[model samples]
Structure formats: structure tokens, C-alpha cells
Target: MIASTIKTQYEGSSHDSVLYSKPYSKKIDTLNMPKGYQLPKFMQFDGKGNLKQHVTHFIETCNNAGMEEDYLVKKFVRSLKGNAFDWYTNLKPEFINSWDQLEKEFLNCFYSTRRTISMLELTSTKQWKDEPIIDYINRWRSLSLDCKDQLSETSAIDMCVQGMHWGLHYILQGIKPRTFEVLATRSHHIELSIANHGKKEPITDFKKDKVFAPNIDKIGKKPAKEAFTVNTTPIKTSSTPIKIDVIKDSTQIKPSF
Candidate 1:
């Protein structure tokens, strides 16, 4: 009646069996168990030829308690994801070089009080299903109307373009991105466009016509003013009279008689 009560209380659970069942496991020379020995405890030796106590204990414990191998493998894989490799290989060099600095800059750009990049930077060592880089970027802000409008503003585009320029530089050189050069180039373009966008007083404004003549700024000579010859002398005329002698004088004398 007592055995039946114990059986009823413990049931068939492994924990119950380990605690209540008679000690069925016997300590044998686990080091020299023959091939035919049924359920012989397995053992492992370290490089120094010493038998590891933990291995023997764990095997005996698991066999006594009925632990399976699949559960052990799952736990192992989870551990490898955290400790196997450095996570920064998949990220930009600049970000990896000075994570703290980049985190600060990223925070400045974050919208909706989000810290997506910061979190990834902190947690990338763990294994996960592969995702594209931009997916990682867009995590901080949702694709809502206000977010899109904020991203479309002048300051935002300028920041993005500048960020892209530096990011490319970092990728190409495999080094930390230099903010000075990138920001300088951005500032210069902004100032130039702001100064020369619309007010037209002709400073390198050569886009007036398609075909242009060289040296248009310098004035050319009007072909030598048609050279002319002039005689400046005044004409002198004489006041002279010419007398005509009449040959009819002989006829007139005869008529007079």
C-alpha cells in the first residue's frame, strides 16, 4: 500500500523517477567500459590526458534524468550567436571606428524620439535573419506623413547628402569619415547657390546663349573709318568777254548806200 501511494504521488515524470526510483545507476570504471556493456557511461579526455569530471558528471546526471541532445544544441547555437564574431564588419568603417561619435550624430538625425541606429550598434553581435542596410536605418522613424515631410525639407536633404558623401568616403578608404571636408563642400555649394541663384549682374553668367564668342568683354575697333581723298583748293574764274567781228559788214555798207 505504501509503494502504491508513492507511485501515485510521483507518476512517470523524469524528476520523480530520479528522486523516488531506486538508484539504478552503478559507478563503473567509466574510463574502461567494454563495447558490449549496456548503457555504459561515455567519457571524454582533455589534451592533458586527464578525464574531465564535469563530462562524466553531466552524462551520468543526464542519463539519470533523461535529458535529450536537441535541447542542448539549441542552447549552443544561441550562445554562438552572441560570442562567435565581431559585429562591426557589416557596418561602415567610420561607424565602427568611433561608435560613440557616430551614435551622437545619428541621434541628432533621429525623428519621433527614436534611437534605432544606437540600438543596432549596441546589439549587432547577435545573429539574426539578414536584413538590408536601409531597413536598419528606417527603424528610428515610421513611414508616416509627418516623417516623410520632415525628411523632404531642405535641412534634411542637405544632411542626408552630406552623410552620404562621408559614408562613401569611409567605405572607399576603409577609415573613419572626415566630417570637415564633407561639411566644407556642402557649405560651399549652399553659399554659392544662395548667392547666385537669381540676381543677374553678369558674374560668369555665360549661359545666356548656346553659341558664344570669345573675348566678348573686350571692345573691338570699328573698321578704319572709310579713308577719303579731298582737294581743298578754291577755283579762280576770270570775268572776260569775247567779241565776234561781223562778216556782214560788207553787205551792211552796201545796203547803207
Candidate 2:
């Protein structure tokens, strides 16, 4: 009666049979662990943080340690703790055959819907009047990580442009979506438009149909002209202009001195 009562307390559960219900297939079970192999403690998942990040960390650790394929399926469970360990303990015995199957199960059990990126947040994003186009695009890129739908570069750029003012929107709408230089060049145009949006812009007062050359500020205000000292001694002069005689074949100026 006592045995039956004890069975009733934990009945219909794997906890009643053993501490853990391993799910390794026959091939995985027959593979012997390498001599002096140690359980890795470099990282552990507690079923609370990002599941994808945990999986990535686990894979990276396995690669760096040169762990064999069978060792990977067998040794990964040792890194779990608390809730993660509890989940592992309940896995069906003699069922898991590969690392991929175990990882898929782990994610299915712990993946949180709250962590999903909101489409509303990505779609409703608006660039502030003074915010830079690069900053706006970068913001979109950053948010794409958590967005529920995986956003493509073209879709991201289109969404970001929708929030921008017409000045930048026009230039960026159909141009190179991922080019940082193009975004930078248009950012100035957006900010300038925003800066001058509501006020009367200052006019240069230039008349139409007349071209005016730019005036250089460094030009002197007046010519440096001064009266020169003339030679007071006068020599006798011929009324006719003096002429120089030259040989037809010679083409050189003769010095009068």
C-alpha cells in the first residue's frame, strides 16, 4: 500500500523512473567519450536570456574546443542550469539522435513571444525634423534585429524614407538604398530644409536676367597712383618722331644707350 501511494504521488512522470530521461539514439549512446574529456563551463543557459544567443555561444564553444559530433550531442546538456536543466531532465529517453534535433527542442520550449520585434515600432518610426538621415537609417537597421518580420534592405530603406521630410525623401526614395555616401549627401539637404521650413529665407537681392560677378573683398579701394618727379633739364628735340634704322635681315631692338 505504501509503495502504491508513493507511486501515486509521482506517477505518470519520468521523474518517477530516473533522475534524467536521456534521448540519445543508439549510435549516440554507443560512442565513447574521449579520454580526460571535461564538461565545459564557459557558458550556461538558464532559460531566461536570448535563446538564439545561447545556441550561438554553445556552438562557438564546441567548435573552439574541437569537440567531435557525438560529443556535441552528449555533452551539451551539462551546461544547463535551473529551468534549463529541468527542461533537459524531462526530455524523452532514446529519442534525440543529433545536435540539430536537441537544439530545435530547446528553442521550442523556451522561445518567448515577448522578445519578438514589433512591426508597429518599425513601421511607425518617424525621423525627427532635425534628425540626420544616416541616424534615421541606422536606427531602422538596429530595430530590424528585433522586428517580428525579417526586413530586407530595400524594405528598410523604403520604410525609413516614408518618415523623412520631402527634401530627403525625394532623393533617397529610389536611389542606392544601402550606400552611406548617398544618405550622407542627402542628410544635409534634409536638415537645411528643416532649418528653413517656417521662416522667410534671406534673398541675395540679385536681379533676374543680369549676371553679376562675385566681388572680391581683398581688392584695393583705389589705384596706387602718385605724381612722379620730372627731369627739370630739357634737351633740344627734333619736331619729327625719332626713328631707328634697321637692316632688313635683322629683327632685334637696338639699345639707344
Candidate 3:
């Protein structure tokens, strides 16, 4: 009877285990998602300004990764380093709860009014000596974005042309490009033309003789001076029959009668 009871208990346990058994499912690793699909390293905010760029990049990166608002807030806080981390930790619990609120506060803390003024001043930027036209244009365009008022395409093209080197600017002026795209294309061609022209050897008129040439005879000798032997004696003539001899040197004549 004891052997039979143990056998029956064993059979019942086996049946229960089979009924409760689950198939193994592979666990998904969030950190090691497909190669390029993995989350990017968090961008740390330094207090040196450019808060807009830093925050924008962070938001864009998180959005691309399909991170939810909660994850966004957590990742942003985790990414902070040094003073930034300390400042964030000290914020009220409510302030840290909303990602949008956090971003707004972050910008308020870092973005300065002076930066906007500086951006406005960029409209007056002139091309620096030896600065490339393309570089000047690119810098102006970048600064324009930071301004409170965005620059129009025509205004941007004008600013770019105005900042260009005088030589290039003069050439582009004649082309009279109505659009920024046209201006850029024309400027590129002009720049290449100038560069190619500089590389060329200037054509010479070998046909014309040089004004100054080496005189082998006069190399070491002093220039000759004129000497005249004048005849002071009056001529003795009978009925205008008198012979006069004139001696000529390099610069004067001596007469004998």
C-alpha cells in the first residue's frame, strides 16, 4: 500500500508539471538592439551656452529611438554631468517630471538674451580678408538662424554678396543673380576662374625688344666726355677764298680756318 501511494503521488506531480510548463521565449535586450538601431550616447549639457542645439539634438535623437516621455526625461537627466547634473538634481520633483517643462527650464537657464543680439548683429557681417566666399556665406546663414527675425532668401543672398571679396563681388554684381542658388553657382564659377587664372603663367610679348640691355663694351668703362679745340685766330681771306677745317668729336666740333 505504501509503494502504491508513492507511485500515485509521483504520477500526479508529473501531470501537474506538464500542465503548468511554459515554452522559453528569448528576452529582448534594449541596450543591444540592432547595430545602428541602438540608443545613442547621451549629450551632456555644458553651461557654455548653445543650449538650443544641445537640447534639440538630444530630443531628436531620443525621438528617433522611439523613446517615450518618461524615458526621455530619465535619459536626459542621466546624461547630465558635473555642474549640470548637480543643478538638475536640485530641481523640484514636479519640474523634473515633465520632459517639456524640463527642456523649457534648461533653455531658460542656458540661453542668453545677449546671444540674440549677437545674432541680429550678424546681418552687418562683412567678409574677412582671405576668407572664402562659401565660408562667409555659410557663417552668415548659420548666424541668421539664431536671430529673432529670420532672414529672407533675397536678403541672405545680398548679405553673402556684400560680404564677398571686392573682386568676386564685382564679378557677381554683373551677373545680377535674383536668387541665392544662382548667386552661389555664379560665385563658385568666378572663384574657380580666379583660382585658375592665378595658376596660369602670364603671357609675354617676346616680340618687343627690352628698353635696357647689357652693353658688353660699356660694362666697366667710364662714359666718354666731349673735348673741343677751338680756333681763336681770325681767318685771313682774299675775296672770300679761305679754307676751313672742322674736327668733330663725339659731342662737339673744333674749327680751324
Q: Cα lDDT of all candidates, in order?
A: 0.32, 0.68, 0.63
On lDDT, the leading prediction is: 2
Model 3 clashing residue pairs (backbone) = none
Supply the TM-score for candidate 2. Answer: 0.49
* Clash counts for the predictions, in order: 0, 2, 0
Worst 10 residues of 2 by lDDT: 202-211
Give stretches of model 2 more than 4 Å off.
Answer: 1-30, 33-42, 90-97, 114-124, 128-138, 146-155, 170-177, 180-257
Candidate 3 residue lDDT tens string, 37-118:
5667777875665677777888888878877554566567656777777567556434354566677777777654445636
**Please, what is the TM-score per model?**
0.14, 0.49, 0.49
Model 1 compared with the native: what TM-score? 0.14
- Estimate, for each residue in 199-232, the C-alpha lDDT of model 2 and write its tens digit: 5443221113233344538865775554443333
Compute the lDDT of residue 187 as modeled in candidate 1. 36
Looking at candidate 3, what is the lDDT of residue 150? 67
Full candidate order by lDDT, most accurate first: 2, 3, 1
Per-residue lDDT, model 3, residue 252, is 41
lDDT of 2 at 94: 79
Candidate 1: which pairs clash? none
